[model samples]
Target: MELLETMLRSISAFTLMMLIARILGKSTIAQMTYHDFVAVITLGAITANLAFNNTISIRILLTSLLTFTGIAYLLMFFSMKNRKLRSWFSGKPTVLIQEGKIMESNMRKLKITLDTLNQELRGKNIFNIQEVQYAVLELNGSISVLPKPESQPVTRKDLHLKNQSEPAFPIELIMDGDIIDANLQQNDITREWLHSQIKKKGLSIENVNYAVISSNGNLYFDEYKDQIEHPVDKE
Candidate 1:
């Protein structure tokens, strides 16, 4: 049947895509470089054709996909080994802000306007340009910011506090009322402990929208409903 054929094609295409992605490692779409961008777009078009185009046979589609994957892997390997090739493939990070002053030349070269720069800065919680000590425009179109020493958050080390341990990244234990068993196991937490925490809050696991184990080994949870009380401003 035509419906079955379509379903088979869709499944095959998706499986192939996933296999290719796994082989390529975990450089997400956001982290992709100029070379990767081109390859990904071309691969997507090929995938769509594989899924829908009757003219393109599965054998040809797979061949094309494998060819592109091989090329991508080759480029990735070379880029990692060669600095010049890496720079050419990924481009270089440009200095957008230095010592609280905007570099107009670099901005113009990158085609970034003052307003756009300000917006990106604001996204990093900087309202004013003067607060930034250094800001580099990464090749992947992200800004790496360094705030002035005074503007930066005061750390425990800065206060001469000792015996402070490095924090672990928070691990998601539950999402949309479903337990993330792998994450729980990786973090060395048991389901019994999670259920106990939920019961202590006078809530059920099903009522929880999301839950995470914080760096300090605390259970942070968000219920399906908003429960915070906000004071209204009279002014």
Candidate 2:
């Protein structure tokens, strides 16, 4: 009974620690910023101590969990409330490339190398560095690529094509297993409309993976046929 009680307490502590991480913010686990590298190290240390300390009391476990959660929640709240605080907590984006030229000073300051830049560019489907008009290294450790003007694809507007209609913000009627009523309401569409469309597409709400309505009345959709879900991959 004592062993069982210890097991339960350990599980509870570990679960609470994870719950705090989730509430803190969304970040790609595959990508790590400089701050994230430190966080990973710190979390490993704390969790390792908790795991090995067999004689540790339940009070200690709960206290540590609460303290960690409270501090993170408060910091996130403050960051959201104050721009200065937000900037301090989360550094501003750095321009890695400007006007087809690498920002060497900014790159070096961020410990960014040409090889790393190339890797980031390859992830964005741009093979040639010269093709990049602007590249911003985001605080979240993702790369945003802007192609050079001549290298960019020709848009309809560039060819003097007139599109005189309000753009549609695609409504997701269903996600995973939940029906999104709020999305339908915002689009001024009814549940019945969604039901009919799903039926016409030979897809039930449960089978519908994703759906979107483009500005020009283009209906785009993807079915979540796979049981496994994946998070967004960052460069």
Candidate 3:
């Protein structure tokens, strides 16, 4: 029947889309460059037509999808290998502000207005343009701001304090009462050690909703029930 055929086509298209997404990798989902945006729109169109346009043969729809995907893959690979191709595909970062001075010509070239620039600066917690040493317009439509040295926050070095080594990233050891065995093994931590730590806190693994080893090498556990007298953000 036509209804059964439609259902089958929809399911097939959905499956193919999932496979394609995995093949394209995370960068496509995270950062949308000009090429990535165009590819996504095109892919979406193809997917929708394949799912609902029963007038078109399934073979033709699939061929279009696969051929487009193959071409995109080739372009991405070459773009990585060549600087010119990469610049053409991703576009170059433009300097909007240099040495505490606004580059009006560059801003005009990008069609960015003064109001838009101020709004972007405000988003980065910069209320005054005088505080900015450099501001760059990235390919992804984000403005990267560098504060003037005098306006920047003071660091430990400024106080002539002893420098400390950077701490390791936090590692999750348990989630929803389940132990992450791989994380434990990778970190060279034994099950017995984790159980002992939990026992010391007068709690068990089941009592923990989430647990992680902090950057400072401290074990932190969050229980399912948080005994807060008054939740400020309670809706």
lDDT of each: 0.82, 0.69, 0.83
lDDT of 1: 0.82
Model 2 worst lDDT run, 10 consecutive residues: 162-171
lDDT string, candidate 2, 161-188, tens digits: 5534432323456644456677678778
Off by over 4 Å in 3: 1-3, 161-235
Error of 2 at 8 (Å): 2.2
lDDT of 3 by residue, 129-188 (tens): 999878989888899887875676778665784553333446788865778798899989
CA RMSD, predictions in order: 15.1, 11.7, 13.5
- Among all windows of 10 consecutive residues in model 1, the one with the lowest summed lDDT is 161-170
Point out where model 1 deviates above 4 Å.
28-30, 161-235
Better of 1 and 3 by TM-score: 1
Better of 1 and 2 by lDDT: 1
Arrange candidates by lDDT, descending. Answer: 3, 1, 2
Q: What TM-score, to 2 decimals, does candidate 2 have? A: 0.59
Cα-based lDDT at residue 162, candidate 2: 52
